[model samples]
Target chain A: MSIKKVLTGNHAVSYGAMASRVQVISAYPITPQTQVVELLSELVADGKLDAIFVNVESEHSAMSACISASAAGARAFTATSAQGLALMHEMLHWAAGARLPIVLADINRAMAPPWTIWTDQNDSLSQRDTGWMQIYVESNQEAFDSIILAYKVAEQVFLPCMVVLDAFVLSHTSEPIEIHDQEKIDEYLPPYRPMVTIEPGKPIGYGALAAPDTYMEFRYKMQRAMENAVEIFEKEGKLFGDMFGHSYDLVEPYMMDDAEYVIITVGAVTSTARVAIQELRKKGEKAGLLKFRVLRPFPFEKLRELLSGRKKVAVIDRNISFGHHGIFYQEVKSALYPLSNRPPVFGYIAGLGGRDITVSDVVDIYEDMKKRETLEEIIWKGVKL
Target chain B: MVEIRTHGRGGQGAVVASKILADAAFRVGKYAQSFPQFGVERRGAPVVAFTRIAESEEELPVRSNIYEPDHIVVLDPTLLSIPDTFAGLKEGGWVIVNTPELPENLDIPAKFRVATVDASEIAVKYGLGSKAQPIVNTAILGAFSRVLENVIPLSAILNSIPEEVPVKPDANQKACEEAYNMTRIRK
Candidate 1:
């Protein structure tokens, strides 16, 4: 029987890990994401969960434990945010290249400048080139479902996956999430069988230093593995949908079919953008939203299809690349550059430094989209005007 | 729709309280969303979490930080002396505080409904120890269950606690029951 439970994004992540039957958990406490480890620690301590909880000294150590655990033929999990993720930058490349298939829940927080501990998308987006698949969540329920899907996809491709949620915005926010039965989850996702296993009986070398002769080949193999993930991602997602009631095609769309204009966003911003569209449509505006739930692997093919017929598009990014356009807009524009039927695209960067973005701000963007607006590179919206 | 906000330190169960409140509300068939506003996620630091309970779909562009909470549960009464604690409570809204000594001399806004309970005392009496977590949330939920009659039933909440706590089940159940009884409706 399904039971309704109010859970934060953090708790949902832990619950997902529990449902995934995670064999090992390695984590160090970090703000915004600390409660995630805290709850998991409580579960492990109380013997409610049978997983091994490895208490590491730092984020780097935490990631290391996960890597080791995964290499030892276990379903490993860990979580971190902000600088903690930054600290694991080198090992992130290690985990992906080694093909350990570890799942990480990254509570997206802003990197230090004025030394702030607030919610932003830069932390996870900055790790885009590390050969890890990234998934953004709009709600706690999505956070719960994303981690389960993440584990399945990661194991299928033997690559690491990161499920990103806004730190304070979604991480600590509570929402009603339906908890699935263990038997059903087990039926939906079977036990992880490693394509590789390292034990004393079969000793194997991992992450051996490569010379110029094999370095490019190793990197190429990693690229091919990521490409493989794209297909497996679809298969696993379809399977998840067949069993569960909710499903999305890597990227989730809201009223985008046969639309004159579209606004693009990621994470929780998509929820607000949908609300804005509803308000605008009431006034007879032909507007819709293309929410990018999966940031990594770019979903370039889907972007091409969604933007091909639209007249105008605006990409809203929570992270600024500093001195250049918003990162997401650059990706969107480049993805559509080859197509002849591409729409006029605009980029808007707003809500940095944990400044909350409101629905009226979204309505304002849709109004501008209706006007078919343009700027040089990226325009900053909602500036106390 | 009724919005509830909980104020406490980082280590406290403010966020958990918000979740339990939302869960209880949902158990009774109300739509709810609970979220926290945190800057420093360090222990003992002040933290704020919010919940929105409605009878219909919850739609908004900008999710506000509970500018006008229908009810405010103060896990730490000392926070009253701190700045910006009770800034935006709606007039006629209820404030439940966890302190033995109510601020009799303190000026309360007219039309405010105020109630006081020694939540820590009840927690200690129930062997919740100095780590005032988990229980405070339950006690507050029990008190709230009584106050907001239609929101949730107290029995539903007791049934939700995991079965692993076999030894202290009676204490927790009693603490919640006592808190439900101890709640004094505002005159």
Candidate 2:
């Protein structure tokens, strides 16, 4: 039997890491994400978790410690928010390039100049090309489940994974979730066994300078590993569901069986959209929602198949690409570009800097999508000009 | 579905009170969700928290902040003067306050039922906090259980205190029980 507890999203992440039996944890304190490491440290100190809790002065050092730990054949984990994530930018690429399957929980906080501790996707979106697999979660339960899944998938594909959730929204929100039996989790996720490790007296250079002759091949191998992750994620997800009864995929489709109008969303916004779609259905509107769970290893074929032949589609992005359109908007349009029957994908930028996206606001977007004759390049919602 | 908005000062356990309510609701086999106002909190500054309870998880899927709450809990009586404290409260809802004054004498609209308790005195008597700034969150929740008895039982609230109230579990439970018995309601 699974243990049930009311946990904040941050604590849920900690429990996820603990359940995975992470061998090493190193982190710096940051808003919204602080409670995550705080709980982990307490667990470690209280002897609940037998792991090395490395106290670091900076996020860069924190990631560095995780990289070193994972390189030495240990399961390593860390959690951080906006600026802290940005500070660890260089080391993020290093971890991925080294093919260490370290799991990092990034609470999505907006990049700040005005100094705000609110939710937004800009911080994580900016790290799109770092070669780390990103999974955005909707609920606190998913936040916990995804971490275990991340380690399972990452360890197999030899790629680092970042489990992302909305700052404050998911991070601070408390909800009921099932904490799976440790023996069951252990049965699913065995101890981490690396093919090679930095052992004493075994002189092997790590991340050595790749000459021009072999640099392209290393990049090619990384790309191949990413391609392999797509299938690995599916297989592990199915296996996990068979064991624990909560299966997940790259994307979650809601009310899309015969939906002519679809809304594409990511992260916590999908929860609100689910409610809005139910309300829309009650009023006899054929509205559906497809939540993008995985950002990296973009589900191109999946998007094309789900969005093909739709009358109209709207992509709601909480993160902007500044000069261009919303980040997910660009990805969706790109995915549908090759489809023979591509729908008009409208881009909407909404709920930046922790602005609440109410059910009414979502319904309004659907109404706006239906009323428009021609598609606008970008539509701004809930923004004061 | 029952939505509750809690108003309190920063130093007060407003967020913890919200969590405790959610935990109590969950103890009775109900789905619960709670969160605080997404802002930097400063001591003595006004803070708000929300708790949502429903029969199923689907009913509480919407993650946005609570706009129109079914009821309101005020931890600090001074916060009652702030218009935003009652901004989106539903009509004919319960207004549970922590004040020494009687519910009938308190300045609240007659449309809503008011329940008042001297939670400060109860908390202080139990030594939950200090004489000047007593941590009245547990006591207020006790009064909440009394006023909204049908929503969540007093036993669940009493049972949830030991796990949630970290500082002084026994004292907090006693304060809650006292406030539950001492609460005065003007309906």
Candidate 3:
């Protein structure tokens, strides 16, 4: 039997973690992400969940506790947002390179300069080379489901994974999400069996200092794990789908068949794009959407196939690389660079902070894609110039 | 889809009001979504909350904040004097305000369908106030349900009251019922 409840995306993630039977949780509170840790703490205190709630002074210590618990062969979890995530920068690399299967929830909030707490992808996108797998979610259900699936993939690849949700958009919004049966989840995900442990019984030295020769091999091995992770991601996704009657892929195609124009977006924007695409199609225009599911593996091959057929592919990003264009647009262009017959890729940046991006904006994007050809590097749509 | 924008001061249960309305919609088999705009706001500071009710979960997929709302609920009528409170309000939309005065005392637009209720009096009667400030969120919802064309059953709101408001659930239910019965609608 499935349990259905109205929950914010943060609470959905918390429910997912509890259902996954996380053994240890240590996190410092942050805006939008505070509810996640707060609810988890409640569950622990209520005796509804069996987990060790570690009190930490800062995000750095929270991650360190996660690292220690994971290294000791336990399923550890933590959550943070914006500056809090930045504070865990050092531990992020240590967890991934150490090959510990720790799962984290990063509520994607904008970085502070003038000091604003709002939704944006820049925070997580800036950590592109952190060696942790990043999976962005669109809804509360996706946030709940992805965290569980992420743990399975992380454990298999021996790499840490971060399940990301947009700051206030997903993190604070409440939606009806179905909670999976604990027995079914138990059947799907077994207890963690570490391939590595720092126990006296094993009698092995861990994290020894390495010179150039040994350091290169360890780095190469980490790359190899990331490569395998791309495949393991799909495998676990399929496994979860079969059990839950829902499936997720790296690229979700919406009415893309025989479409001449496509709008590419990540996270919740894709849902609005779908509505606009349908509206365009009603007016006798061929328009579709591609929602990027996983950012870590990048899904370059699938991206090539999806973009090859369309005449124009417009990339809408909520993040920028400062001086350059949008981060996802740059990646899309690089992915299609080597293709002999690739469609034209246009970039549009909009809805930074918590600004609203309505269906009309998407309709405007499709109209722009139809009218423009070879032109500017990027169009700053909806931004006051 | 029916979009609602709620206006109130901090510590007035405005955010919790949105959540309860959304939960009530869910109990009645309608897809519901709700959220509050978070910032640094203390007591008596203005805050906004939003709720979306749709026939299907997929119908309410947009995550953007609602601007042109189909309905507006004002937990505090003091927001009426602010010029920006009525921005992006859809023409012919309903406006439910918690005030005891007749329609002449309100600065209500001629185009809006107005509903008025003495939520403060109900809150006072129930003793659900903190010192000088009385929380009228639940009481206003009572008026909202009566004026909302019965989109959701009153029982749903009654059932959600105890779960959402921990203090004085029975008294809050009484206040809500009293407001629902006494609400005056002027189209």
- Superior candidate under lDDT, 1 versus 2: 2
- Candidate number of the best DockQ: 2
The chain A TM-scores for the candidates, taken one by one, are 0.97, 0.99, 0.97
Docking class of 3: medium
Residue pairs with clashing backbones, model 3: none
Where's the lowest-lDDT run of ten residues in candidate 3 chain A? A198-207
**What's the CA error at residue A41 for candidate 1, in Å?**
3.7
lDDT per residue for candidate 1 within A61-114, as digits (tens), equals 999999999998999999999999999999998899898989999998899977
**lDDT, candidate 1, B5-62, per-residue tens:** 8888776667767776776666667777877786556777888888888875454233
lDDT of each: 0.80, 0.93, 0.88
Clashing pairs in 1: A173-B35, A174-B34, A359-B61, A359-B62
lDDT of 3 by residue, B10-67 (tens): 9888988898898899989999999887766689999899999998977888777788
Which sections of candidate 3 miss by over 4 Å?
A: A200-203
DockQ of 3: 0.72
Residue-level lDDT of model 3, residues A1-385, one tens digit each, is 7888888999999999998899999999998799999999999999999999999999999999999999999999999998999999999989988899899999998889868888888888887798999998889999999988988888888999999998878888888999998899998888999987877677776677999879999989988898888888888888889999788888888898878988999998887788888889999998889999898877888889888857888999988888999999999899999898888888999888867788999999889977996755588888886
For candidate 2, report its TM-score. Answer: 0.99
Candidate 2's docking class is high
Identify the superior model by DockQ, candidate 2 or candidate 3: 2
Clash tally, candidates in order: 4, 0, 0
